[model samples]
Target: MSKVRVAVIGCGSISKHRHIPEYADNSNVELVAFVDPVIERAEEYAAKHGGKAYADYETMLAEVKPDAVSVCTPNYLHAPMSIAAANAGAHVLVEKPMAVTDEEAAAMNEAAAKNGVKLMVGHNQRLMPPHVKAKQILDSGVLGKVLTFRTSFGHPGPDGWSIDGAGSWFFRKNEAIMGAMGDLGVHKSDLIRYLLSDEVSEVAAFIATIDKPGDVDDNANVIVRMKSGAIGSLVASWTYYKGEDNSTVLWCEKGVMKIGTHPEDQVIVELRDGSVEKHKVGEISTNTKQLSSGIVDAFIDSIINDTVPAISGEEGRKSLKVILSAFESQATGQFIKVN
Candidate 1:
C-alpha cells in the first residue's frame, strides 16, 4: 500500500498529542477514522483530521478497514482493541503496558501474528533521540561495563494531561490497572532493556497510593537485577510537584552515563580520566511539551516496508513482565523472579 489508511482508537490526550498528530504528519499515512466512546471526542478529532468518527471501535474497524490502527485506549482496553484490529487485518500500534495481564498480552501478540499484521507497542522512550544515542554508545562498548543504574519518570500527575483531566480512566484502578507503574514505570522497564540489551532476572518493589485518589498505586520504587548481574532502581511517581523528571543514570566500570538529567544536555558521560562528554541529541517529550515521539514514524515505516516494528508485542510483554514481577514483589515483600 502506497499510503496506509490509519485509524486512531482513542481520542484522549495521547491520541490528541502524539498518535493522531504524528500519523497525520507522516506522508505515508492517510487519516481514515477516529474512535472514542465519547461521541463528541471522536467527532471533534474527525472534523479536524478528516475522518469518520465512531463511538465504537469495532464498528470503525469493520467500516473503515484501515490499513493500521493505533490502540491508545486505557490499559485494560489495549489488548482487546489491538486484537480486534489485528483480526480485522489492520496493523496495530498499542500504547505501553499493553495489557493488564500476561495472558492478554500473549493473546494480542498471537492475534497479530495469526493475522499476518504488525503489532507495535508505544514504548516511545526507546525511540527518543537521547535514548537512541545512548544505545549506540553502550553497544559500541565505549562504557566498559554497567555496574548500577537508576531511572525515574515522574510528574505532577496525569490529571493535567488526560482529556478527561482528573476524571480520566488513569485514576481508576479497574481501567488503568496500576496507576503510575503501569503508566510510567513500564516505559522505564522497556527503556532499560533496550539500552542495556539485557533481561531483568529479578525484582523487588515498594508500591503505594501516596497522593493520588485511587485504589491503584501512585508511587512505585523497584529494584532490579539484570541477567548480566547489573543492579538498578526504577522509580515512577505522580508526586513530583516541582516538575517532570525523566532521567536515567548508569554507573559503568569506566564512567557514568546520565540521560535526560541535565537541563540543557540530553546525555552526559563522565569518564574516570576526569573528562566529561555532553550530547544534545534532541528534546525528550514531556507532559507539558508534546514533541514528536518518533513512534508514529516508526510504525508507519514498518507498515510501508513490511518490517517488524521497532518495539514489537513480545518486547512489550517482556517489559510488562518486569512490572508484573515488581507488583508481585510488592505484595510478597520479597524479590520476585521475572519469568
Candidate 2:
C-alpha cells in the first residue's frame, strides 16, 4: 500500500552509480536512509535522495527501520551486511557474486529465510533484454539440445574508474577476495546459467593477475561442464585495453544464441537452417548505470505480488559456487565440483 522504504548500506561507486539511483527513481520505493563509514559520502547521497544520513548502520536500523536495504559494500562485507539487514527485518538486494564463498552465500540465504525476507542478488546482466531474449530462445527448443557455450566480460582496469584516479577496495586482496572472477566473471557464469537453465557441475580454470597492478587475478578463464551434459567456458578480464561489457555464445543442435553488447550486439539467434534474427538491445541501465531494465522492476513486482524472483539468492549462490570452484580448480589443477 505504502512505498517501500529503502536504505543503502554503502555510498561508494556502486551505490552512486546503481543502487541510489535505482531506489530513488522507483516510484514504489522511498529512499529513506544512507550508510557509509565515511559519513560525508552517506550524507551526500541522503541529501540527494531526500533521506537521512547514517555513519553507523546499526543506528540507522534502530532508527529508520527501512523495509529493505541494498547491500552495496565490498566483496567481503556483502555476507555480513546482508545477514544483518535480514535480521533487522529488512529485505535485501545484494550486488553480484553474492559472497566470496559458498559458505557465506549459504549463510546469507539462511539469514534471509530465517527473517522471512526476500534476498535478491543484483546480477544485472540477467536483467538485460538481450539476455532475456536469449533465455527465451534457448528454452523455446529452437536451440535444441545444448552442445557447447562460451561467455566473457571484460573491462579496462578500475584505475580510470573515478575522475580522481584514487585507489579503492578493488585492488585490496582483503576486500576484493578474487579479482576478475568476482568482478566480472560471475556475470557470465550467471548469464549462462540463466540462458541454459542448467547447473555448472565442474570447473577447470586458470587465474592470473597479468595486467592490473593488484594481487588478485585481473584475468582468468575457466572450462565448465554442465550437469545437463553441455560444456561451457567463462572468460573475464579487467586488463582489456579496450572492450565493451561482454557476450555469451551458445551453440545448440538447432540454433545458436548470443547475449550482451560486445559481439554483433544484443540477442542474436541463428538457426542451423541459415536463418538469423538479431535484437539491437540497449543497456539495462537508465540515466545512471544502475540497471533500469525491467529486471529490478520485476524484483519490485515480485515483492509486491509475493512471487519468487527469477534471479533469487539461490540463483546468485549457484553462480558464486561456480566462481569459487574456478579459483579452487586453478589451485588444484583438477576439475573442481561445484557445491
- lDDT tens digits, residue span 85-189, model 2: 899999888888789888899999999889998999988888777777777777788779889988888778666663224277878889979878998899888
**lDDT by residue (tens digit), candidate 1, 1-339:** 468999999889999889988988998888999999898999998889898999999889988999999999999999989999999999999998999999999999999999999999999999899999999988888888899999999999989788888998999988898899999999999999999999999999999998888788999999999999999999999989998999999999999999999878999999999999999999889988889999999999988888999999999999999999999999999989997
Off by over 4 Å in 2: 162-166, 261-265, 284-295
How many angstroms is residue 177 displaced in model 1 relative to the true structure, after the best TM-score fit? 0.9
TM-score for each prediction? 0.99, 0.94
Query: For model 1, what is the alpha-carbon lDDT of residue 123?
Result: 97
Count of clashes in candidate 2: 0
Error of 1 at 320 (Å): 0.4
Tell me how candidate 2 scores on lDDT.
0.82
lDDT of 2 at 306: 78
Clashes of 1: 0
